[model samples]
Target: MGSVQHLPYSVSNHCPLLVNKESNRSSLRDQRFYFEAWWTLDDSFEGTLTDIWESSSAPLVEKLKIVQIGLKKWARDLKFNKGDKKRRLTKELEILLMDDMDEETLKIHLNIEIDKDEVYWEQRARTNWL
Candidate 1:
């Protein structure tokens, strides 16, 4: 009888090391890309705000008061957004559990769906450009 070779799944197609290396490189690239894009976008927005403030005829105190009010509103909105997300996740988890799903499975699903929304502000912050 001829002996059969049992090739590993990864080796049968390609090297495992190469696959891991590519994945790591892609992840790093994505991180760097997002960081740079975020920084540039932030700088542009700040510059625009500074220009507007510098050119405004409003008194300094009035401008400051307006900015303070805006900031407070922004902070409140951020808190509300976070709370809403948490509530949604909790509701979904409860439904899943009520359907006899395991805790771990529910957690994984909730985390994946809820985590994507954590960056909502980065996009919403641009609306302040006016």
Candidate 2:
């Protein structure tokens, strides 16, 4: 008997094997159902601390001070490569000092005064008066 040969969809009168009408309709319906389900869920999301800080009633200068303090603490605690230790330390110190000045400027702008003696006394107490 001669070997059977399959004809291309265009040449064949029968519907193409790849084109399954039922499966396509079901897939589209499933996608639409999932989209509608997701849309029905709650849209509200909680704001993070940074978001709240940025939107806070606090003055811009105070916000900048808080950011500076955070940056300084990050720099102080970060680990640097041994080879670049000195350079990293120098850069960190310079940046931290600049941030400190920015924080002080913010304090001045806010008219929030700090007592140096009181701060010193507190530090002394923390160190057991040593």
Candidate 3:
């Protein structure tokens, strides 16, 4: 079953309408392969990529497909939370600065900021190039 609702439109002449479906249809999208910039920062990333490449025994085209599948799996297993870590580190660094600034804490905070920027620039480069 579906229901239609009329929404008041602001700045527009026509009224907005929304249709809500009650069916349990899947809403997931078919995500394409995209490399994460932060993956390069991980110590094991190089070895893992090398292993994936060497383990594949297919032609060039097939090998590319295998690598894509392997990368998707690897990304799923990574479980990295960059945004959460950045926010938490920022808060911790602020507290540390209020008391007594430490070299290690400052370094860790800077590293996180660098990682965030790397991801941003990587995406920006891809957008510009494409």
Best by lDDT: 3
lDDT score for candidate 3 against the true structure = 0.73
Candidate 1 segments exceeding 4 Å error: 1-56, 86-130
Worst 10 residues of 2 by lDDT: 33-42
Over 1-130, each residue of candidate 1 has an lDDT whose tens digit, in order, gives 1223444564367533322222345556543412212222222346544555665567898876555454444444544665675677788788878998777865864664355454445454666477
So what's the TM-score on candidate 2?
0.20
Q: After superposition, how far is residue 123 of candidate 1 from its true place, in Å?
A: 26
- Against the true structure, candidate 1 has what lDDT? 0.52
Which of candidates 2 and 3 is the stronger one according to lDDT? Answer: 3
lDDT score for candidate 2 against the true structure? 0.41
TM-score of structure candidate 1: 0.26
> Per-residue lDDT tens digits of candidate 3, residues 8-66?
98898999998888633333224566777767776567988899999978999999888
Give me the candidate number with maximum TM-score: 3
lDDT (0-100) at residue 47 of candidate 2? 28
